[model samples]
Target: MTDRGRTALDTVHAQLDAFNAHDLDAFVATYAADAVIVGVAPDPIVGAAAIRAFYESRLANPDLSCTIDDSVLFGTRWVVAQEQVVNAGVATETIATFDVVDGLIARASMLKA
Candidate 1:
């Protein structure tokens, strides 16, 4: 991988680590201030604050954990990750496509599998 692609991939890994640890602050830090998140709800979530709130709601799951099975890095600007989210003994598969900008995630769209 190119240096740029490695950097973006590192950022994504960091974000995933933060999420699995339930560290909301660190998780939010990996996103741009105006980041957009799709597929979590009917409407897209805009901005860091809104994204934080959405994640907070998900914290209700005491056994929440996210595992990335595969990740395809597209240059330094995008990545497609196949993941599994397990919470409360239920596992759900998801594919998340991330748009990376300046080493931060600018947008992420997730699709349930």
Candidate 2:
């Protein structure tokens, strides 16, 4: 991987680590202030505060956990990740598309699998 590509992957890994750690603050810090999250839940969440709230709600469930399986880069600006979410012993698969801008995530969209 090129340096840029490696950097992008590292950033993504960091975000995933924060999520797996259930560190809401660290996760929110990974995105731009105005970053938008789509499809991670029933409704789209806009901005860091909203995204934080959404994650907080999920984290409130003791059994909630996220696992990222694979990530494919679409050029340098975007990446699509295959993820699995476990909550209350139920497992759901999803695809997450992330738009990276200036080394920080600008937008994230998730689709149920």
Candidate 3:
């Protein structure tokens, strides 16, 4: 893979690792300050702080965990992945699109499947 592709994939892996570990600090660090998250609520979640707050509640659940089932990296900026998320004993599948810029996640959009 090219350096840019490797960097982008690395950032994606880091974010997933942090998320699976439920490490709020590390998870938030993988995102840009102005990163936006969509499909979690009625309106898009803007900024890292809001993203942190949004995840805080979900991560607080002890039964929450996500596993990447499949993934495809497009160029050096986007990663489209299929994930299996389990929360409160319920398993749900989601397709997620992540945009990486300068080694940080700039935006993420998730769609339930």
**How many pairs of residues collide in each model?**
0, 0, 0
- Top lDDT hit: 1
* Candidate 1 local distance difference test against the native: 0.87
Model 2: lDDT equals 0.79
The lDDT of each candidate is 0.87, 0.79, 0.86
Off by over 4 Å in 1: 1-6
Question: Which is the winner by lDDT between candidate 1 and candidate 2?
Answer: 1
lDDT of 2 by residue, 1-113 (tens): 11333455666777888887888887887787898888866777889889888888665666877888899888777988898888888889989888877666889998987
TM-score per model over all chains: 0.91, 0.85, 0.91
- Per-residue lDDT, model 3, residue 30, is 87
Q: Clashing residue pairs in candidate 1, if any? A: none
For candidate 3, write residues 26-50 as lDDT tens digits.
8898888899999879999999889
RMSD of 3: 3.3
